[model samples]
Target: MSHAPHSPLPVGHYAYDEVDRTFLKQRVAQFRDQVERRISGALTEEEFKPLRLMNGLYLQLHAYMLRVAIPYGILNSGQMRALAQIAQRYDRDYGHFTTRQNIQFNWIRLEDTPDILALLAHADMHAIQTSGNCIRNVTADQFAGAAADEVLDPRVHAEILRQWSTLHPEFTFLPRKFKIAISGSPQDRVAARFHDIGLMARNGENGRPVFEVYVGGGLGRTPIVGVKLRDDLPEEDLIAYLEAILRVYNEFGRRDNIYKARIKILVQALGVDEFRDRVNAEFVAMDRARYRLDEGIVAAIRARFGVPDFDPAGQAAEKLAQQRKADRAFDFWVRTNTHAHKQPGYVSVTISCKPAGGIPGDVTSSQMNLLADLADQLSFGELRITHLQNVVLGHVRQDKLYGLWQTLEQNGLGTANVGFITDIVACPGLDYCALANARSIPIAQKLSERFASPDLQREIGPMRLNISGCINACGHHHAGHIGILGVDKRGEEAFQITLGGAADQDTVSIGQIIGAAMSEDETVDAIARIIDTYLARRTAGEQFIETCRRLGTAPFKDAAYATA
Candidate 1:
């Protein structure tokens, strides 16, 4: 049988044979038994909590949230179709895709979760690592193997990590949740710099794949960018380096306070150079035999992630562009949402999960089915979930873009505002989180309406507006070009604004707050005022960050505080 363009299981990874299949078979049976016990009162909530959470079941504000893992962010149309069915049949008619590359059905019943897991397992997917403090779904660039600027597909490395970290005895119970992100491109769209471990693929002087490693970065009450430990370690040293870092973190990272228990806190307290030295020392003393990379193993892993079957025809993009002249809306989508692919005749199209006033990453069941069908029709049955909280129908031919956009528009999935201000990233705040002080979704929704125009977004020129309900920066507000942090001021919900924040390859500076906090209503208006000020003050062709830096924060700071 011919392989699909983007195979979910890459070549180098272990294939599901009789033995592996039997393990899954037994695991499903075991979970089914656990569910029956819990339902029949043989298991209490406390007893079933850990077991269910391990299988990606969480009781949230409204209902049980079933988180299904998309390991390393790879998915096929059929799996997505199953997800659509799950949402339509059992959930709240929609599912939310999180930054961790997992989808959550927010309205699942406690008794229905096992059936959901079984359904997912049938599709060669599962919800493992969806919760608990163990290593979560390892994420990489959504573009992955298809990015034009990528040096190497980081999914290869991500898959390796996924295999090694799965149910590992040593790192399972860590100080806190651990996140790892990889970027094969220098563009850093995946925001690797803000993760627990950020691995960037680069070529050494020998032109071989080497990794630039960053450690101790995280968000929430304290936001810090990772510090580089090794600039050019060969691919073979990945396991050794990662093991060394994890050992140090597991041993010395804070455990007394859950709030300050992340590796970032330990790294910050110890200092970067000291941390690096500690990691290096641990690496030197470690047993190399247990973790060293085997070329054959790496080769097999590489084969699984092999590129999709794509024709070398060069005229697709041009032909698509020509068709756009006849359809203006399709042309808008082509210009704004379609990204360049390494392969000619193909482009990566972002299926915006953001609809006016809707949640940023929420997709309806019908939308999912349409997307799955659309992916199969246009892109050889492959799709990717982006960290920005959207979907990508990769490998779309230029010629079929118009029809796809028409379909997307009919399904409420078509929004030409890919990088627009309305396309916001927000955390599930007071509504669902135990730690939140304010609501983030309303803030995002209000801000989206405030600057809802595509023309204004274009004029603003690539601005990122991120909001977090509390100090835990799950929304990644610290990295936004214009970051808004929600705080509690005298028991009232208030917001603080920051400038010059970024989460890219060149810089990862945490945004500096300009002044005192404001009420939720005023907060939305204040963001508008800030953007208005930017429009008035920026020099010709200056981006948001450049204008903030060139004119100094005093101007924007004063503008922000003027209403304080």
Candidate 2:
């Protein structure tokens, strides 16, 4: 698998077929009425909470956290602008893009939620299943359809799943939440191995799409990489495969202990091979093609994701060079922030929401609006939210990089460090999530501060430091080259370290714990020791992983413990 990453198809199992404009308008009215009842006390908070959550509203620490689904990680410029408007009018100054390819507004009020939903509906967007123990937002590689290495657009399958899972009756109340991710590319940019279900698209001998299914992988208290259960499953078996996985989970996943409730535990307890056997038996028992995916349906969904037109006749290449010659800043930005697109005249640009020492995925309302405007003006009316918690302008012409950078810089998004060390993926640890055992934001901030130098990050060459608030692995710490997981030591916070973990195509390795957990203050110091050990032992051009493996963790472990 080398192209890009895939998403969790189960999340997309409930995509309603597009109806006429009249029905679209009618559904909005119905939801609006429900909102009115909830807000006006006609519906109690207890009665409304589930409904609101189903609509992607969460009453969080300071305010309501609204999770808007970017179905299969696809968004048009019109939709992006709609979200920007919601950020500006109803909430605070900005939004947070999430690892699920969703955008969240942290400052929404309860009263304004319906209006927000209404706006999203207008753009054919909603916040359904963003929370609760049901399937979450279906996510795929941000570069899904357009990546050169992709075999087929995984989003098409994601859309299929969304239709199947939406308000599904059988597995809705399973022991705990379920997450799924799929990928079509060999390069695992979407972090499939860390997801509950990871689907890789491969071609069969007949040149048809076949799926490789991975089950039981997760991030929380138990971080286990998913185990592949079935290989070369025919395209028609997608739904049956999903049913089998969920049935096994729903039947045996623990419910008594919340901490032990995830499917990962069930999969682990049964052992990977045994679990696969059980799922296969269940699949065999199901009515063959009972959940058959209709070709017409698949085609209809694909039609919704049509590619934006690119004007090959335009002055693209020459203009790009002129812009580069005119501005060194623009030149550097092009080299770092922009990615080559399959389309000749267009490029994909990453907008870093993680400024130095700032929260990794925070986007202001103003910035969101500007991005929307820019999307319409320069590219197609579309923007994509990435699993890395960054926003991407997918169809930007290389010629417009200068103007885009100029506008983005003013909005605090022009950080010319896409794959640098400072571009960390961290969860909203103890400060926000109830599941978090330790604080993650501060640790991320410290790491950012430690590796803020552009030169240092470049020298390091794509080191990923993922920090989780807890073992639940929301931060994807288990897959980072340098992974940090927070653990609860009695009532205090401690950090556990793992080295050589990687979330890439060639290899999927969970880092080994180099040493025992350390206190918060000592954790950063521990990371420093690890980096120093790597630097000292590196062969020319050797990556952190290569170095770690060559020397093993012994030397780094010794240094960290010696200081302790």
Candidate whose TM-score is highest:
1
- Candidate 1 regions exceeding 4 Å error are 1-20, 326-328, 489-492, 561-564
lDDT per residue as tens, model 1, 1-564: 122355555221224446555666677778889999998999999999989888888887777888888877778778889999899999878888888878888889877877887787777778877888788888888877788998888877888898889887898888888999998876787788788999899878998878889888887778888888888988888998898999999999888999889999999899999999999999999887788788887887777654566766567667776788877767777788888888877788998888777788888888888887787777777788988889997777666777778888888888888876777888787777667788888888877777766667678877778888888787888888788888889998888887878887396788888888889888777778788899998889888888887887788877766775
Superposed Cα deviation of residue 259, candidate 1 (Å): 1.9
lDDT of 2 by residue, 1-564 (tens): 011112222112223445634554665677778888987889998998777776777776667788888877777656777877887898776677888888888788776776787788777777778888888777787877767677777888887788788778987777888888888766677778777898888778898778888887777667778888888888778898898889889999999999899888898899998898888899899996677766876787776665555667378888898888988778877988887778787788888888888889877767777776776676555677889888887767667777778888887888877877788888888887777889898988888888777777777776778888987787888778888899998889999988878766467778777778989779888888777777778999998888876888788888777778
List the candidate 2 regions with Cα displacement exceeding 4 Å.
1-49, 313-332, 487-494, 516-522, 561-564
Q: Which ten residues in a row have the lowest lDDT in candidate 1?
A: 8-17
How far is 104's C-alpha from truth in model 2 (Å)? 1.8
Model 2, global lDDT = 0.78
